[model samples]
Target chain A: MATSHTTEAVNLPSAVQERQRRAKFRRNMFYLALLAVGLVAPFVAYPVFLMKILCFALFACAFNLLLGYAGLLSFGHAAFLATGGYVTGYLLASYPGLTPELGILAGTAMATLLGALFGVLSIRRQGIYFAMVTLALAQLMFFVFVQSSFTGGEDGLHGVPRGSLFGVIDISSNLAMYYFVFAVFVFGFAVIQRTVHSPFGQVLKAIRENEPRAISLGYNVDAYKLLAFVLSAALAGLAGSTKTVVFQLASLTDAHWHMSGEVILMTLLGGVGTLLGPLMGAGLVVSLQHLLAQSPLGNWVSVILGIIFVVCVLSFRSGIIGELSKMYRKNFK
Target chain B: MTMIFGVPMAVFMGQLTLGLVNGAFYALLSLGLAVIFGLLKIVNFAHGAQYMLGAFAALLGFRYLGINYWLALILVPLVVGGFGMLMERFLLRRIAHLDHLYGLLLTFGLALIFEGTLINFFGVSGARYATPEILQGGLNLGFMFLPTYRAWVLVAALAMCLFTWFMIERTRLGAYLRAGTENSQLMQAFGVNVPLLITLTYGFGVGLAAFAGVLAAPLYPVSPTMGSSLLIVVFAVVVIGGMGSILGAILTGLGMGIIEGLTKVYYPEASNTVIFLVMILVLMLRPAGLFGKEA
Candidate 1:
C-alpha cells in the first residue's frame, strides 16, 4: 500500500511537468532568436550605443546574480566595476604590449580579490547593515582612488589602448570592438546562466528563500553567499574592464556610488532574476540616457529616473520582464 | 606655543573644537536616522537630501522671502517636516508591507530627484548663508577661540538630541511611539493611531535632519551635493553605532567625529577614512553594533 501510494504521488504531476518542460523549451528558442537578432543588431543600430548597452547589461546581470538569487543587496558594486576598469585601463594604457584580453582578465582577478575581502567583512552582517558595510567599503575605495595619483585623481585614466584580441583580431574599429563586447557579454551571460542552473545556484536560491532552513539542511550559507558575491563582483569587473577598452577611458564615473545606484536601477527595470531582464533594462536605461543627453531634458534625466524608481517600487516590483513573463504565463496557461 | 603630539596646543584645541562641531552635526543627523529606523525599519536615504533641502530652504527664505536666520531656523524644519509627513502618507505608506530595501531604494531615488531639481534651480556652485548678526563673532576661550555660531550649533544640537531622547524615553507619547515600534498592530488594536504615529515619527525624524541642516547652512556652503557627500559618512556612523539605540547613535556620531578630527592632525590623509575604518573594526568586533541587540 505504501509503495503504491508513493508511486501515485510521483506520477500525479506528469502532465504539469511536461507542460513546464515544453514552456522552458519554447523560452530557450525565444532566447536563441533574441541572440540572433543581437548578432545582427550592430548593422541596424549604432554600434557604440549597442556596446554601451551590452556592457551595462552584463553589469546588471552580474548584480542580479547576487541580489535576485542570493538575496544580498550590495550597495558598493561600483567599487568592483571601478577596480576592473582602472586596472584594465592602467594596464592597457601604460603597457601597449599587454593584450586586451589579458588586461581584462587581470582586472577581473583584482575585482574577485576585492569582492572576496569585502564579502568576508560584510557577509557576517545581515540585511541593511550588510548594505551599509559595503557602501562604506566602497566609499573607502573611492577615497583611495581619489587620493592616489595612479588613478589620475579627478581626471581619470584616459586613452586606454584597445589592443588586439589574442594578437590576431584588431578591435580598434568600432564594429570590431562592438563584436568583441558582444562576445564578452555572451560569455558572461552564459556563465551567469550556468551558475544559476548549477547545484550551487539552487543552494543559493534556497538560501534566499529561507536561510535558516538552508542552514538546517547543512549548507554553509555564508560560504555560498561569499562565493556568489565574488562571482558577481568578478563579472561586474569584466563588464567594466570591457567598457574601458571600448570607450578608451576609465573615469571616476565608473567608481561613483551613483554608478552603483544606476546598476541597481537597470537590474530592477529589466527584471531582477529573469535572464534577459537585465539586458532589456540596461538597453532601455542607456537609450534613455543617450536620448536625453541630446535633448533639452538632459538635466531632468535624474528626475525621470527617480520617478521611474518610485513607480517601479510602488506598483511594478516585478520589473518589466518579470511582469511580461507573469502575464504570458497567466494568459497562456 | 605649548606642544602636544608635536602640534601646537592651540591647533590641537582648534581641531578638537572643529571635531566637536562636526560631531554635533553627526549626532544630530544620526539621531534622526536612528529614530526613523527604529519605527519605520526603513533607512531614510533621503535624510541627507532633506537636510540639503533644509539648508536650501533657509537660503531661499533669505533670498526670496527676506526671512532672516532665526526665523528660517523655525520655519525650515516645519516645512521640511510637513513634506516628510506627506511623503509618509502618500508614498512610503504604499510600500509599508514590502521589503525594507524597497523603502531604501525609493528614498534613494527621492534623494536623486531632489538633488537634481535643486541643482537645476540653484546651480552646483552653492550659495552662502550669512552667520546671523547676533552670532557672527568668535569668543576667546583662553586656549582656543570659538566661533559663536559654531558654539551655538553644538549647544543647540545637543539640546535637540537630549530633548528627543527625553521625549522618547520618558513621556506618554514616547510610550505610545515605543509601543507602536514594538508591535504596530497591537498598538492599533489598543486604540492608538499607529499609522499617524508612524507618520509623525518619520516627520519628526526628518525634521531633526532639517534642523541640523539649517544649523549647518552658515558653516558649510548651501549646495545641492553637500548632503549626499556627508550622507555616506553619517551612514558609516549609523552602522558603527548600531541602528538599535538612539543614545548609541548620538555617542558614536560624536565620538567618530572627534576621532576623525584627531586623525586629521596625526595622519591627514586618513581623516576622510577613519570613520569607515572604525566601522569595519566595529563590524568585526561587534556585528550588531556597539549597543545593538542581536538580531
Candidate 2:
C-alpha cells in the first residue's frame, strides 16, 4: 500500500549512495582545509590584520544566517555590532578588573537583548518593511550613540585594554591574542554550523522558502525568525566585542549604516546560503579594503566597493563560491 | 520678542518655520518614494544620493556654467531624472526578475558611488549656494519674520506635491498608472506598455526628488552628506506614511517635520530622534502604518 524510505543509503541506489558519500567526504575535507588555514593564517600574516579578518568573517557569517537562510534582510545589523563593541570597550576601559572574556560575554548579552527588542518591533513586518524599519531603528540607535557621552560621541571609546582571557592567560601579545580570536571564531562557526543543521534550522529555511506554507504546516514562523535574528545578533556582537579587544578601539564607524552595507557586500560577494561564503566574502573584502587604502584608489574605496556591489547584484548574485559550486554541480552532479 | 511657553516666540516660530521647511523636503522626497514604490515595489535607497546630485548639479551649474537658480531648477530635475532613467534601463532592468531586495541593493551601491565620488572631488565641507536674487530678503509677519527663500521652498514643494498627487490621482494617464500599480500584467494584457510606464515612472519619481534637492540647495548647504541623512529621515517618513498613497507620503512627511521642530523647541535633545520614535510607535500600533494599506 505504501513505499518505505528511511536512510539515504537504503533509499537510493548504490551509485547515488556512493555519490552522496563522496559529497559528504568532500565537504568534510573542505572544512578541514579551512580549519588548517585558520590555524596557520596568524603566523603567515600580520596577527592584527588576521584578527580583523576573523572578527569580520564571524560578523558576515552571522549576517548570512539571517539573510541567506532566514530570508530576512536586516539593515540594522551595525547597531548590534556597535552596541557590542561599545559595551565591551566601555567595560574593559572603565572596569580595570573586568576580564576580556567577561567583557565579550557582557557585549554579546547586550546585543542579544537589543536583538530581541528589534525582533519584537520588526518581525511583524514582511520583506521591504522589515528592512526599512530595521534601518530606522538603527539610525535611532546611531543618534543615541552620537549623543550619549558614554560612546564618547565622535571620538568613541578608545584605548581599551585587552585584558587576559581568563585570570591566568595573558593575551596582550599579538600571537596570544590571535590564538584567542581563532578559538572564538571556531566556536562561533561551530554554533552557526550546529544551528544550520538542526530541526529548528530546517523550519527557518522552510519559512524562508515559503512562509505561508510553513505556517500552514503549524510552525510558529515568527518565533523561529526572532530566535534566528537574536542568534545572528549575538554572534555579530561577539565578533564586534572580539574586534574591540583586537584593535583596542570602538568607534562610530562600526555603527554607521555604511558598516551595515559593507556586511551585505561581503555576504553577497562571498555567496549567500553557503556556509563558507561569508567567510570568503569577508576575507576578500577586508583584504581589498586593506590593499585599496594603500593604493592610488585610497579614497576611492567606497566608489570601488559600490561598483563591485552593482556588478555583483546585476551579474554575480550567486557570487564566487556560489558560481563555482554551480559549475561544479553542473559538471559532476 | 514675545514669549511663548517660556521660549521666545521668534525662536519658536523660527524653529517651526525650519520644521515646515524640513517637512517640505520630506513630503517631496517621500512622495517620490511612494510613487516609485507604488509601481516598482522597490524602495530607491539611492534617492538621497540622487537628491544630492540634483543640488550639486544646480550648484556646479551656477558656479561653472553661469546657470542661474531659476534655470537649474528646471534643468537639474531633467538631468537627474534622465540619469535615473538610464539607471532603470541599464541596471534595474536586468534584475527585474529577482527579489525586491536586489533593487534596494543596486540603488544603495549607486548611492555610495555617487556620494563617494562627490566627496573625492569636493571634500565634505560643501559649498555655499546663494539664494536667487528675486527670492532674496525676508517677509515680515506679525509674530515672526520669514525668509523669502524658505517661503519659496515651502510653496514650491507643496505645489509640486499637489501637482504630483493630482497627476497620479486625477488625470487619465494617472488612471492608467494606478491600474498598472493595482495589477500590471492585467493592464499589459489590455495593451498597456508596462515596461515603458515603469521607466517613465522611475524618471518622474526621481525628478521629483531632484526637484526637492534644487529647492533645498539654497536652504541647506549643497553638500555630499546632506542627502544621506535626509534620506534616512525620509525613509522613516515613508514607513510612517505607508507607500499606499502619494498623499499619505506628503502629509506624514510634513507632519513628522513639524513634530520634529516642536520637539526642538521643547526638548531640543530629542528633536533628531522624535520622528524615528514616532515610527516605532506607529509600527507597534499599526503595522501597516498610519496611512499605509497592508500589502
For each candidate in turn, the interface RMSD (Å) is 0.9, 0.6
Return the lDDT, model 2, position A312.
97
- List candidate 1 stretches off by more than 4 Å: A1-17
Ten contiguous residues minimizing lDDT sum, candidate 2 chain B: B286-295
Give the alpha carbon lDDT tens digit for every residue of A177-277 in model 2: 99999999999999999899777788889999999999999888989999999999999999999999999999999999999999999999999988889
DockQ of each candidate's interface versus the true one? Answer: 0.81, 0.90
What range of 10 consecutive residues in model 1 chain A has the weakest lDDT sum?
A: A1-10
The C-alpha stretches of model 2 lying farther than 4 A from their native spots are: A1-19
- Give the distance in Å from residue B227's predicted Cα in candidate 1 to where it truly belongs: 0.7
At residue A111, give the lDDT of candidate 2: 93
Q: Considering every candidate listed, which one attains the maximal DockQ?
A: 2
TM-score of chain B, per candidate? 0.98, 0.98
- What are the lDDT figures for the candidates, one per model? 0.91, 0.92
What is the two-chain DockQ of model 1?
Answer: 0.81
Best by lDDT: 2
